[model samples]
Target: MTARCSMRLEERSARHIDFTGREDRPVQIHLRDIKRTPGPPNPAGLDHDMSPPPRLQQVPTSPLLSAFSAHRSETLSAGRALFVEGDSGSDIHLLESGLIALSHIQPNGKRMIASFVVGNGVFSLSHDGMRLLTAEALQECRLRRVHRVELSHLPADQAEAVKAALDREPWDIQAETLMHLHKDADEGISYFLVRLAGRLNGPISRGSRVRLDMSRVDIADHLGLTVETVCRGLKRLRSDRVIDAAGPHNVIILEPDQLKRRAGLGPDFD
Candidate 1:
């Protein structure tokens, strides 16, 4: 990715000024070749569209699942996009299992992950029948798509559940947005981990283990921080004994109260 910088000079050179206010001199730009970090090997034959039309495997069904699966059920292999931004959004999606990411492509072609939909989460309730973000599978996923009209036909209990899920989405997004408001990187990262742990690992206790489904890159994009900042923040958290990194994809909450303190949150924040 090309990095950009802004410059200001009072010399009125009427020419491009470099970072140090040097004018009328060729600004030397250095290109660095950085190797992409290797992640898990891609699943074979799963790229460039899930051929033969992905279908869901049989699983025990529930009232909510049955209602949502009325029209269609599908699966997406890891790394496959379920839908891109600007796609028609007449149907709502219920993620039965695995992880999905909702993101937007900026004008500069950078992707900003808006949120992640964990298992049993409901998403894509678009107000204008238009998708504002793209949805992609972070893991092999099972999902159901139901037409908007079908929501009214669901049983009262199921309808209420759906309503509650939708209701929580805004608050969740708001909390994430608030995380970005903090100027301190560690504070923002701590708050993000706490919110994510609540969603992925249930109630936050000292021993709660959160499976980090999203990568550091994803976290950086979602939190509006550089990857280096995220790395440093996590290092500080570990050093302070607030959390422990079990692996590349697992984190254990060591001192929940301390973590909340670091995040500038109350004990009852979660």
Candidate 2:
């Protein structure tokens, strides 16, 4: 017997139903033909309700970023490759502005987006001396490239700052792995938005929006879901009033607690 599932977008939510079939072959359902209802209009004066969260206010800049502020920077145009997978890891790339995507290509040639490193972030951290994934600019990016050996030559205080930043890398990697393993598509998307909002240097409050530089396809790749699934998930969120979209790339979180609930995160999570 073959097992099959059918998913339909309800007026207020999305649900899937499973069924058993007598056929000996697996069943595949195509979702390409499904249509999403247009989202509601943005309410007038919605921006006034949004405020920057308290944590975003008065946060100090990273000492590591300050230590390297005087260094010469490099720029890459959108869609340019920063480094290739399996390349020798020679430099740590610090993002000054714009978005960078870290991705891995499987042996089957499928490219999976692992994460996005926004400004004030560092990438290419590995214990082994080789790149495990490729890095590319999602937009025109400004970056500071520091060779590994150069860190040891820095002033003691500056070097310590860099070390402290590097120490947190493992925690981030572990958290990302856990998020992927634990959440379904809907929860994952909500968690991604919350994390992205927290990373932004500016203020984010209820009704405050985050601009997503990546496309829906890119988001799906990062979350390990199909494009259709991401779209359906977003639609459900919007319909439930947990979030709203100003446009395709910008998401305004309407209800932070509700969004966090959808993400399966605790209330204390920023």
Candidate 3:
């Protein structure tokens, strides 16, 4: 005979967890949630196209430049170095007019141009740190140099806008650098032309043209190609009837679609 013991189970009422402590935690802010003042409406009466092509969208107008315009402005002649690599990055530069080239020096002392900073572009955003790349004026330029402390003193909204722009700058440089690195000389040249056309806001018509102010040497440096290779590539594009040269600095896109294909941008072209 075995004596069995009976066990009884009792259910307890569920208790609500306290989330009051979580309410005291800091709320994270997102870049997209920061609203920016709308820019002036287009005078051309064209409806604003929010979704631009990748190449065109790569360099958007920086709110930092606008906010800092009155701080300090200086003009530099063509071929002048704005800042050399390894220099103290106490200040950031905003290109108001003309072009600036950002380059890196190799161990052998050869300079490799990495990217071009066009008007309304910001560069050297290291902010009181050592500069990562050398900046030079590709053409006569007017730039506004703002000290890191000044940027820090900006209003919260404007400061956030500047931060967003600064965050995007490196990714733009990498995308352009990789674009040139992976393509053949001809394709690279075509890509450069297409990019310039887009930047210049040239018409998208078949017969539309764009003026490339940079010389062949500049193009070579920017595209990571030899000057001779750039010349040959240009000649090939001309022969293919994809483009025609109005002068040494001007290029007409005779066949926009064909040029886009050669640039590896695909059939959608724009």
Q: Estimate, for each residue in 170-256, the C-alpha lDDT of model 1 and write its tens digit.
A: 677667776677647877888888988888767699989988876666677778887667877887787778888776678889999
What's the TM-score of each model vs. the native?
0.72, 0.74, 0.71
Model 2: how large is the Cα RMSD against the reference? 15.4
Backbone clash count, each prediction separately: 0, 0, 0
Evaluate all candidate structures by whole-model CA lDDT and list the values in order: 0.67, 0.67, 0.64
State the lDDT of candidate 3 residue by residue for 38-64, as single tens digits: 233331111222443355333335566
> Cα-based RMSD of the predictions, in order?
12.1, 15.4, 26.4
Candidate 2 residue spans exceeding 4 A from truth: 1-61, 201-204
lDDT tens readout by residue for model 2, 1-270? 333222122222223211111123332222222222333232110112133445544433766776665456666656545666665675776888898777776767556777888988977555678877667666778787677788888778877887777777657866886788799888998888888888883434688788887766567778988767777888888888888878556788899888888889877776
Clashing pairs in 3: none
Q: Relative to the unseen true structure, what is the Cα RMSD of model 1?
A: 12.1
Clashing pairs in 2: none
